[model samples]
Target chain A: MDLFEYQGKQYFARFGIPISKGGVADTVDQAVAQAEESGYPVVVKAQVKVGGRGKAGGVKLANDADEVRTHAGNILGLDIKGHVVKRLWVEHASDIEREYYASFTLDRSAKKHLGMLSAEGGVEIEEVAVTNPDAIALIHIDPVDGLSLDTARSWVDRAGLDEPARAQTAELLVKLYTCYTEGDCDLAEINPLILTPDGRVHALDAKVTLDDNAAYRHPEWDEFAGSDVEDERETRAKERGLNYIGLDGSVGIIANGAGLAMSTLDVVNQCGGSAANFLDIGGGANADVMAAALEVINSDPAVRSILVNIFGGITRVDEVANGVLEALERVHISSPIVLRLDGTNAIAGREILADHLSDRLVAEPTMLDAARRAVALAGGQS
Target chain B: MSIFVDENTKVVVQGISPTSQGLYHGLRNRAYGTHVVAGTNPKRGGEEIEGIPIFATVAEAVEATGANASFISVPPKFAADAIIEAAAAGVPFVVCITEGIPAQDEALAYNRLVREFAGTRLLGPNCPGIISPGRCNIGITSGDIALPGGPVGIVSRSGTLTYQALHELSQQGVGQTTCVGIGGDPVPGTSFIDCLGAFEADPDTRAIMMIGEIGGSAEEEAAEFIATSVAKPVVSYVAGVTAPPGRKMGHAGAIISGSKGTAQAKMDALAAAGVTVALNPTEAGEAMVDIVRKLG
Candidate 1:
């Protein structure tokens, strides 16, 4: 779950990381008020989850209330890489002496926590990694031992930070590590962590991606839920504990696992049909879950046909068939549902569904055949 | 010899109880002829799950039953600690079927194993475990869909897709030596490369089929390994070509962030490595069949 920049800044502040004084404005009037509160010379930055806000004219510097209102109005509705700006982050502009980069993320290859600190900042880290690899100081910390203040100081030294800013930057790195670990962030990046003429250091930008798996531990994460770009179908599916993604197509997909659900979408497209949504019932494909999945997909106006693809692993197919039958009694689906059940009592499951086979409820032996049938039923690709 | 598990592999199930999902699969594995020797639960120390003895700790379970491999099916909160306990108890290989374990816990478990228990290999904290078809079934993969004594070896990131690849191959009258689900998480105890290297070393396995999805460089790294290290015929299928950017797409690791970890990139990497990259699972299975026919 990616957080808006303003939210990230606020999150960093929660961990005692110094951030520029800022206020989030949802309206143009609020933007002017925020600029006045910040004492002018504020940066009216568009709050979107994409990069190049400056290039897209979404970022502007305002010296006064009039300038704040003008820039805020222009950036509030501006689109950066297809993300329409609905919020503005008005922050007091910093006096930058130099820019440096710092971040903490998982090193999937090493299966460890990786921290990168670079003297070079204010640009994509990937570019620096490719062009001047030595410019970035790479450190792999064990999640068990995490980052230490002493280790962070040497890392800052390795990154060739100025002597005056070294201690503050090192201190900030420790705090950021805490934010990454205790905060349950998948990534905590501060590009262009600025060094002021007064020898103070602070995060000029924050890009945070929280780990959704850790939401169970932190109920406070519910506050970040408002920024999520979820649709009605997704919210309904979430209510039923089904993993569903809304897509703009005619065929609705229901599968047993993540890999299979994604492959189901690809197969539907291969059969010349687009999917309306991607729904994974996971291990429990019981009556209530099946009924809830059907109700969510059935609500989609684009859905013309549904494909139920279940391959029993921990999930038993015969029981899943019974669940589907029970689900049919609860939810009245408008479109046809093509069922393809295999693995673990699949024959018995097929035997159970044999009596219910009809124009509305059909079963195919193979996923390819089931997908083809679903696509044909949905009137093919548009 | 099969990779990971074979007839000689004695198994100890952690967190197994009469009503737990661990016991449920434990019975199924025993029914399939696996040596589900002992179970460990602190609370149910003397209790048994369908005649399988339960011990208080993995050390006791391992000592009593001589179990070399451990299968974990604990809840999310305790799943990592279970893996750590199994590894600490000298279980050389641990496969965790429990899902929703926090990334921090998984990372801690993974790092701890690599550092302290260098000999132990953890397969997953949230995954469908491995099956060496007709020989040993580890976790939740349905043994009925698997066929034994064949040339093809399979490994996948997705559970159902792993089964789908097996079903697609078995339906075409082909069989697999072993099929492994590495689990679709940000940090898996095992990787595609681990299973690929094992398959490459196994003489009975002639060809390999790999199923990958979006997120992480596991697929790309597997491609590099296949290009340089592996000599067997490799066919691959990468899911999530249609998955939109920045969405979770069900799996925790199955998301496209920014411009990285796309299906196309992984597929391109695999193809460049002489892997038969199929656009879909069915097509991938068919490609493997073609490879098998040519080998014949």
Candidate 2:
């Protein structure tokens, strides 16, 4: 899960890493108050989980209270990459002598922790990788060996960091590694790890992505739960424990696995119709889960037809069919459902669905047929 | 001639009991003629689950049953330790069917297996495990859908999609050599490259059907491997063509981050490697059918 910049900074601070003093605010008055408390020349950054906030004019410098109010009012509702700013992070602006980048993520192929450091910063690392790949010093650290001070110092030297700030940068890199490994973070990025005119180095921007699977180990992450700026449908789906992504198309999709769910959406498009949403019921296709999924999709006015494709292995097709039937009784679905059941006990599952065929309920012989029927019912003629 | 398992491979169940999913799938595996000889449960060491002897440790189970492979079905929290225990017991092959294991734990387990237990092969901490049809059934995948024989080797990142591919192949009267789910986790114990390499080396497996979803560089790397090493006809299908970026599509690893790990990117890479890339799973089945028929 992506955290807001403020939350990322706070997470950084927890690892004893130095960040610019900052405060988060929810209102214009609170922004001004935070700015005043942090001293003048504060950077009012829009607290959003997305990138390109600066290009979108979501980050503004305010020297006084009036300017702080003006910028807060402007940025609070400013949309960056479809993310509307609801909160503001006002931090004391730093005096930068130079900018650099540092991040630690999993080297999935190598099965190691990958540390990327570059003297060139304040821009996308991908850009630096394209222009001058040598500018970025990449290091692979085994989770067993971990990141050491000597290793980090050598890395800092390789990245050609400012000699004066190399010690502090290396120290900060060690702390960041701790936060990345021990803090249950998928990614801990400090873009533009800034060097001050005085020889101090610290993180200027924090882009942290926490591992959702590690949530079981870290209970403190509950504080970051309410920080997400999600749409209504996404929030509802999260509440219902369904893996769903809302889209603008007409055919609502529900499938058993991630790959099949995505394939269901692709097949809907292949059948000349777009999908209203992407929902994966996972391994559980019980009555309650199916009803919850149907109810969530039914709430969307854009969904004209629903397609549920389950190729049962651990999940039996008979159970899925019974679940669908039982779900129909629990929820009054306005959109017609096209189910394509295959795999274990599918003959019995098809037999169960045979008695319930109608305009509202239909069964298809295959996933492609189901998509074709759902797309046509959704008014996407094919 | 199967890659991972066959009639001679003895299986030991870790965290197995009457109520555990290990025993559940273990029983089913045994019913399918798999040598599910022993189970490990510290509490039920002297007990038995449907005639399968229970042992206190994987070492005892391995010693008693001569099991060369271990099937892990422990919960997420204990999964990493269970893997270590199985590997410590000197099991040559360890397949972890438990899902939702923390990436850190998975990483540490992989590291230990690499550093300390170098001889042991680990498949997944989150996967459907493997099946050599009419021979050995390891994990949660239903054995009925699998056709027992040769000509096709299948590997997938998704369990249901693997079942779909198997169903599609069986429906067309094409038998498979072995099917492996490499798992969709960011740090899978085994990879597409590993399975692809095994499949390429197997004599009975004539053609390969690879089912990949948008996520890591594993599939792209496998494409490169296929281009350089694999000599068989390869048909590929990657899911999430219409999926939006940055959203987890059910599988923990099935997310498109930024412009990377997209279905289009993976498909393009595989296509550039001279592998047949299908638009969807059904079409992929057709491509594989045509390829196999040409081989005949």
- Which candidate comes out best when scored by lDDT? 1
How does candidate 1 fare on TM-score? 0.94
Docking class of 2: high
How well is each residue in B180-266 modelled by candidate 2, as lDDT tens digits?
998889888888989999999999999999999987788899999999999998999999899888888877888887888999999
Q: What lDDT does the true structure give each of the candidates?
A: 0.91, 0.91
lDDT for each residue of candidate 1 in B1-296, tens digit (9 for 90 to 100): 68989999999988877788888888889899999999988998877768999999999998888999999888888888898999999999999988888888889889889889999999976678999988999998888888898789999999999999999999888989999989988899999999999999999999999999999889999999999999999999999999998888888888887788999999999999999999999899999999999999
Q: How close is candidate 1 at the interface, in terms of C-alpha RMSD after superposing the true interface residues?
A: 1.1
Instruction: Tell me the number of clashing residue pairs for each predicted model.
Output: 0, 0
Chain B TM-score for all candidates, comma-separated: 0.99, 0.99
Q: Which segments of candidate 1 are over 4 A away from where they belong?
A: A27-37, A66-84, A130-134
Off by over 4 Å in 2: none
